[model samples]
Target: MQYSDKYLAFMGRAPKKIPHWEHWSNPDAETYLTGIDYYEHPRLCRLKLSQLYPQLELPIPEKDDPKPRPKLDLKGQSSNVDEHGGHHVRWGDTETTQWDWGKHFKDAEDVFAFSPLAQGDFTDIPVVESRDYSDEEKLYQEYRKMYPKEWGDKAPKGSTASVSFYNTMFMWPLLTFGWELFLETCLDPRFERIMTEFAEINRRVFRVFSRLPVNFVICHDDIVTSRGPTCSPKWMHKYIFPCYEEFWSIVKAAGKEVIFMSDGNMDAYVNDIMACGARGIISEPYTDYKKIARRYKDCFLAGEGDNRILYRSNPDEIRAMVESMVETSRITGGYMMCIGNHIPWNIPPKAVKYYLDISAELAHR
Candidate 1:
């Protein structure tokens, strides 16, 4: 099968074999070629290829030099005196520093500053309300001009394009508002209204993109905790699912596949995800693949290798995990093998190579 054919099969076009590729371990441009070569290798001629091009660039932060620890004063006060002589009240309810909420916005004009939108800082700003519709349309047009294949590329021969919106809803609320306040807002009627409004705006942005010829719409929203979801199933059902249903339905209606990426164990929400009309869920290997495959046969599954094991496990252990994942979940189709999450930066490069080489060998079987 060609790469497109294998990808389509994974997306439920036909009963076919899963594609095999090297794991992304090296933080270098070579990873892309390695993936392409893995699919093109003679042993895996039966599978198809799907090339993913990640275009986002981030500034690397400067590292700090290690230093000795400073001694503590231990008296809940500073030993070194300043111009104020460190004589200020040490303990008093009235002496506490007051928070100025006004500092959040620099000024009244800052309300419409909209500088972050130009820089791609979609956080905190209302994407729908803040955006100039004409400018957004121009941006979309430019993207389409640059990568016509992403939208115009047809199946059976060419690769499809997928773009991801940062996991704004989940990230913003937790980072901007305190966690306690965010949770409280979920229960509050007024806050729920705000969430709904934001969700609608997000849905509109997606709708505009869906009108283009893209093959897939991917959204990243981390919904799970170490144990389960941060919000209860009932709460998600009440506040979150409806927005997803609307969004997923719009994508499906537009004839584009929808995939969601989340982290952590998500064994409990597989049904809820299917109900939202998402074609697949990507996450770490913590999710119970066998259970999810048995329940939602049509829904695609991605990422099953345990991320932590990549840093510590030997080649044999990695091979075993890959073999078991393929044997158990790829039987009925709709499975893609990937690291449970992005390969860690500190992992030895050799271990990463071993994981990919082993995965290729297993998939050939």
Candidate 2:
């Protein structure tokens, strides 16, 4: 099988052109690009856009009819209703977010009393949102089912058949205890036991990942915010980074490369993450891409492009952004063109056009 340029880029092979790895959700951009009404013909619109820009890897919908949207009570709300009786101003695919640690436990004391190993099964837990996560073998089988039947138990060489986990390490406690509770108790000596229990859980997780039929594993944990680290470096080294080293080591032993994904500024921890055996990082726009590219020398970095630039709708700025990305690509074989913050549903279509067209014209090694 012919490996895609994206797969090559993921492996740090430096394909002739810089690959596009985007977080896209701009329905208006699709309509503008394809000349199709997205709400009326969602599938055909995506199909045409995919044909137009295959590098974007837009998913081809299996159905022509748009999925049913929720009829929210928009009384006294600013959102306009569409002909389909749905909210017209969509910010993203859905209002629902993953890792919603709803009001399960009452307080920090309840969190401290919890034991991940004793629970063993996490389906009952509000934080373990992923299915089949309680059992390592079952989780492996579940991921195995996602790959093509032709590949059997192993992905083809150079294929991008990979798995991603949202709560890599830091998120385990954060999701389990809820944000405020986690912060309140993280520094206490008792928190070490909680972190230890969380680490044990991830040991099973990474071992399962090692057994999967994939070449890469994308591990996501928002260890930092757009500003900087949420937990200090000293605290992180004690609790978080060690688990990453141990868990990632499990997959690395099986010849699988780890791709560390995070949101916000990862500038401080990039080296630490790399030291933990990640092939590269895909983070938000707050990171220093050129500095990473120059230092790491093409270890698969992305999320340098900013959506704010696109939102501004300035042609020169968009072109300059694309050109700067291309310059970074010249420095590193593993650079991908990505708006780390994302191309949300509200961004102007014309700005999206300029970014893509300019990238096509100039984003080459």
Candidate 3:
């Protein structure tokens, strides 16, 4: 089958090709496609597609029917926003309050001194505060009022939205606290309580946001190392799985899909992750996609391209990577391809363009 037909069928849409590429780079449109504005750089998309399909034209269709807008069922989820303004931290800077817990520990001796034992009591740590329901409810009401313009005329139609709680534990804790202290906390009961408290906060947030119109929630919490998971699967099942299950159950009860995004090699805990109620996983290319696709054919799969190749490799290499990823992920069903992570700032803009362009072409082939 043609790529467009396959994608439409996969999405449960009629097998007619849609003019999706023309609006691929629009933030509003792309968010509908990938669940985030992570890659709304139109120039990048344009350049990438031009390189991948040099002979193919990407003209905006003339006299075409106005395409229906995408709608999602965010019944028990919330939008993760940086209401504080500014992009969330991206490396560097030592004293930012939002530094990952690990990073905080690395920089602040005081935090290390205050580090709690893995099994230590956290009953006194104060239950994490919840968002004001009135405020959130008002926001939702306003959002619903504006949903028509924001989402056009489409209603929930088998579309999904990716919603993550926050950055991964690996990235967030290490950055918020010093690595040593963060590690200590991971092992200590007191630290576990703090983590649990934060998880509660996430739960409350999820409750508020899920009331919106979305269908899938992608919770991100990386626990893997380059070689394998940093902690034992048992440890994750003990400390993290409960939180995931709680939130995932909420999402699933509201009839939305749940997925997780992690980094590094996670070959050992795929079963555990699946048991946590997630339908798919996203990560950098450290894990084996072939194994994952074969093992979890019922779940969705996203990510797995090498960022270094997009930044430094030639066009041929980029094309090869795209083809391999698309083929590998196109296993039984439920796959979407993207950069292993955010595109590096140093990668030539043209290289980024070439990568995305090829992906679009392949998706429509």
Candidate 4:
């Protein structure tokens, strides 16, 4: 099946089969893959593949150096792909070394500054809205190169857009201030100011999403923990949704579909996201898939198989997990089976194969 065919199904358009996608393992996952990769460096070919396809081993030249994997360091900075299609790393938080003296308010900028963003004042951002659009431009170009069918060239497969940018509301605060500081900031009198300025900052930076040629964008916000919303839902409505509301407004005007992704048990916020006009919802295991599929069948639903199962499950347990996800996901025509959150290297290869095998068998069933 052509890659685009499944994408067509995802968009509720006509297609050949169910849609599927996979991302490269993170740099750190290498620790678990050392045995398979053999060498210090691993190639893209060593990344996960569909069990449906025959394995064609590519010879690795001794001198060729594989591209480096991304990193998320302390202070909440990450060279993660969700930000810029892997072009740049995100920088937030600043004070990893401060003693007890740093907790109290020093000034407005301190409130804004961080383990990264604390020193940043809202007004300090230039009104000119300075940023390079080259990353988005590069993505557009890459899409044309890889999926020329979308651009109306002679087509190998017919599918819709899949790539997207990762943006968040509450996570940024968590990244900017440490968890404790961020939670406390929600109670500070200046909380609204900080949120507004950050939202404005996002407004300027995210203009690229609207201008891109594609009609789809992915957004991410890890707003909830395993238990429930980390902060009051009211705070999220007041401080967070406004920013997403504005961001979604731009995409809406551009005539695009947004697939929203998050980690945690955020069932309460599903309606909130739907209100933002998210046409698709990608979630971790914490969110109830069966419940959501029963409610939002019109919207595309992807990602539900928990990574923890892969990290620590026997073959029987893995089978049960896939069986349950398939049962729930198949209810909605838009479901795409994927490992929710992540698949760390520590996941047993046999278990990974088991997951993939089931996905291959039941993807379109």
Q: Against the true structure, whose lDDT is highest?
A: 2
Between candidates 1 and 4, name the one with more favorable lDDT.
Answer: 4
Per-residue CA lDDT of model 1 for 1-365, tens digit only, reads 45553465448553344553223423322233334232124222112212222211122223323222212213444234438444333211112232222235443233233223243434344432233333556556654564656436332233456656654355434433445555645565555545654565566567666666666777777788657889888877876777778877876787778887778888888787778888877777788877777777656777777757777858777778888777755544667667776564345556766666666556532
Off by over 4 Å in 3: 1-155, 167-178
What is candidate 2's TM-score against the reference?
0.91
- lDDT of every model, 2 decimals: 0.56, 0.84, 0.54, 0.58
| Candidate 4 segments whose C-alpha is farther than 4 A from its true place | 1-3, 13-16, 22-41, 47-63, 66-109, 112-163
User: Model 2: runs farther than 4 Å from truth?
Assistant: 68-90, 96-102
**TM-score-superior candidate, 1 or 3:** 1
Candidates by lDDT, descending order: 2, 4, 1, 3
Candidate 2 lDDT: 0.84
**In terms of TM-score, which candidate is stronger, 1 or 2?**
2
lDDT of 3 by residue, 58-177 (tens): 432333233332221122222222676523322111112343333223433455354233313333332122123234455446434634445543325555433445442334344445
The total number of steric clashes, by the backbone 3 Å criterion, in model 4 comes to 13
The window of 10 residues in a row where model 3 has the poorest summed lDDT is: 16-25
lDDT of 3: 0.54
Q: Alpha-carbon error at 298 in model 2, in Å?
A: 1.9
The TM-scores, one per candidate, come to 0.67, 0.91, 0.61, 0.69
